[model samples]
Target: MASKLISGGLFAIAFLGCLVNAQLDTNQTAQNIHDPQPQTPATQSQNTQSKSHPDTQNRRSSCVVEQQNKIQCGAPGTSATVCNALNCCFDGTMCYYGKYVTLHCTKDAQMIVIVSKDATIPNLDLESVGLLSKTGNCSPVATTSAFAIYQFPVTECGTVMSEEDGVLTYENRMFSQYEVELGPRGAITRDSFFDLSIQCRYTGSTAEALLLEMNILPSPYPAVGFGILNVELRLANGQCHLKGCAEEDVAYSSYYRDSEYPITKELQDNVYVEVRMLGRTDPNLVLTLGHCWATSKSNPLSRPQWDLLINGCPYREDRYQTKLLNVGSKLMFPSHYRRFAFQMFTFVSTGAADPSKGNQVTQTADTVNPTYEKVYIHCNVAVCQPSTQYNCEPRCFRKRRDIGESKTFTSRQEDRTVSSQEIQFVALSQSV
Candidate 1:
């Protein structure tokens, strides 16, 4: 009886043990189906590639900011992205469109003379005859102090007047160029001038009338002032009068009052006038002259004096002779004096090359080699700042009447009159 009881107890214990082991096997199988262990080499590689490939795709996406994206432009709050191919540079204020063409400048004066000097009716001299008369070149080579100032009148203010249908094509006549010519002159100022004479074709046809627009890059200096822009034009009689001299209007002159940027005289036709640009001084003491623009004044010369005659020459020769002309002119013109035309905006080149070479810009074009060009500084004695003396009438701009050296004439209208021709510049006469 005792043996039988022992055998039954042992069988019951064995049965219970078998049931527990089966349950353990079932849980292990379930875990295997739901969750796998560590991944294999191939699986890990595939997972990594899956994670990285989309980032590569996202990086190349045009709409999204990518690593090597082409267009990086967009307004602060807006999504207007401009590509690099387009000349849309932010002025820090706004995205403006600009043309991307390389300018090849050479420091050789002979080359500049060839460039700044307008091509005379090379073959047919019809000006010696009557009826058809055209403008002449305004490049005058003069040595002043350590700098050799080359005043090349880029365009005639008269062309601005005759720009009918807005088709003034002076680009071919004067492409924007500045090169420094090294000679005895130690350091030349960047102020320059452009002369406007009659453009006559010997063909003698009225259809030969040509008009064009001229453009200059921003000034090199941080600031520029339109101090003295002397326009010498010839009337039908060939007598050159400083036609656009600032004619003062007491009411208009007072509209904008600034000690640094004062209008010496009102804008007028047929008389050279002293115009002031909106003046602002930077922390570095650099002054800038904003471009003159349109205003509703009684005078026709209300346009910011365009077709600029001279680049720099302080009206007050005593006060600002040492200062250099900042390259770019300001864009905002006073409403009162917007009709005036400008030729060049004087600038300083912050580069390793010569200061005389205005802005030693590199050429990106394949056809032309990289070169440098000389820049100049312009000064005027007439009305920059009124003379302290009481009785001395403002002297007209008079150039040294040297016969061989080219002189800057004031007018296209006074072609035949000798009295209209007052040599405006006197080189080596005054020590600046």
Candidate 2:
């Protein structure tokens, strides 16, 4: 009876242990199926990020990288709005920092910080600052047309240049001759005879004149838009070699680059190039604070074009008028002495009477100054020069008056030496 009882107890104990094991397994299975735990935010973000960037397992490692400055990575094609929100860039794989580019300010004091389009720097926030430019793409402009050496241009409306042997030239000639001189101190000076008016004046003619029509005068010259009134190569010293030059001849020089144009003057001096809009009462002028591009037309693939930093911000040349400033000046480009130069265009609001506003707009259009296409350009062209073999000095091999043989056979005189003081200018005419 004792043996039987012990056997029974052992069997009961084994049965109870089996029941406990089965219950534990059933509870674990139910927990897994019905009582599911919520996923973490980190895990969800990781999974979403993994979809875009396969190598990146989560957001912590790639999307929000901790760099020196809060750099948001992005691609060139990504829109500016989306790039700003996440403080991240769309560098192919959603927000990723690529590289950093320094934006130098031309001002001595307040500077700017701008990022490139390569999804590195955050969209520049200048709203708090008193800056005019908005956050925009900082990509390099594509080359439309580019050439080397210099040549005289053909029958363009104003001025057109074609490549020639040694120099680039204009088809028609003007009273002004442009001379660009490189000073010993790396300062560049360009001299031009600026004709400030549309009408020709009578400046007493000499006997050597063949054309008698040269002397003419109009009392109140017919109103015309501003021609290329003045062009100065803005140098380190805002000094004009020409006496009685405009006050803005040397306004300011800048190395600073903003989203639009980096500030150059300490006090934000307004250098105005005024144009006359027949209907408008206020002054029609372009504000100049020269800002040149560091990237030049050194490569065929990278020539300059109408961009944000240029004088005419929205340079579409549509109904809206825009005028160009910072031409031929250091304010327009990095070096004033590139083999290639700025081919510029600007349209200024005529400040014209808005016909849509039901105002009687009296527009007197002139042939000399039509609607603005490309009013002017600041170019670094090859200076025209005489060949080495050419001889200008009057010589009979320094003849001794033909051995005193009563010589009226004279060597006609010709001026060979050119001076820096005399100003030179050229007008370029063009087509579509």
Q: Write the per-residue lDDT of candidate 2 for residues 1-432, one digit (tens) a residue.
A: 000000000110000000000011112111111110111111111001001112222421323333332332223343445443322334443333322211111111111122222111111111111111112321111110110001111222233234455433322211211222211111111111111111111112200000010111100011122222222322222434577876444433331112312112110122222211122222212222221221122221233222211211222222222323333543233222211122222221223323354321222222121112211222211111123432211122224553233222222222111101111111111000
Give the per-residue lDDT digits (tens) of candidate 1, residues 1-432.
Answer: 000000000100000000000011112111111110111111100001011111333332212212221111222322123212221233434332121110111111011111111111111111111111135433323321111112222243222223445332222232222232222212111323221122211121111211121111110111123323322221111122356543332112222222222111110112222233233222212111221121112232332111122222222222112222222333333211212222222222223233444433221111122111212222222222112332112122445343112222211121110011111110000000
**Which is the leading candidate under TM-score?**
1
lDDT agreement with native, every candidate: 0.20, 0.20
Candidate 2 residue 92 C-alpha distance from true site, Å: 4.1
TM-score of every model versus the real structure: 0.16, 0.14
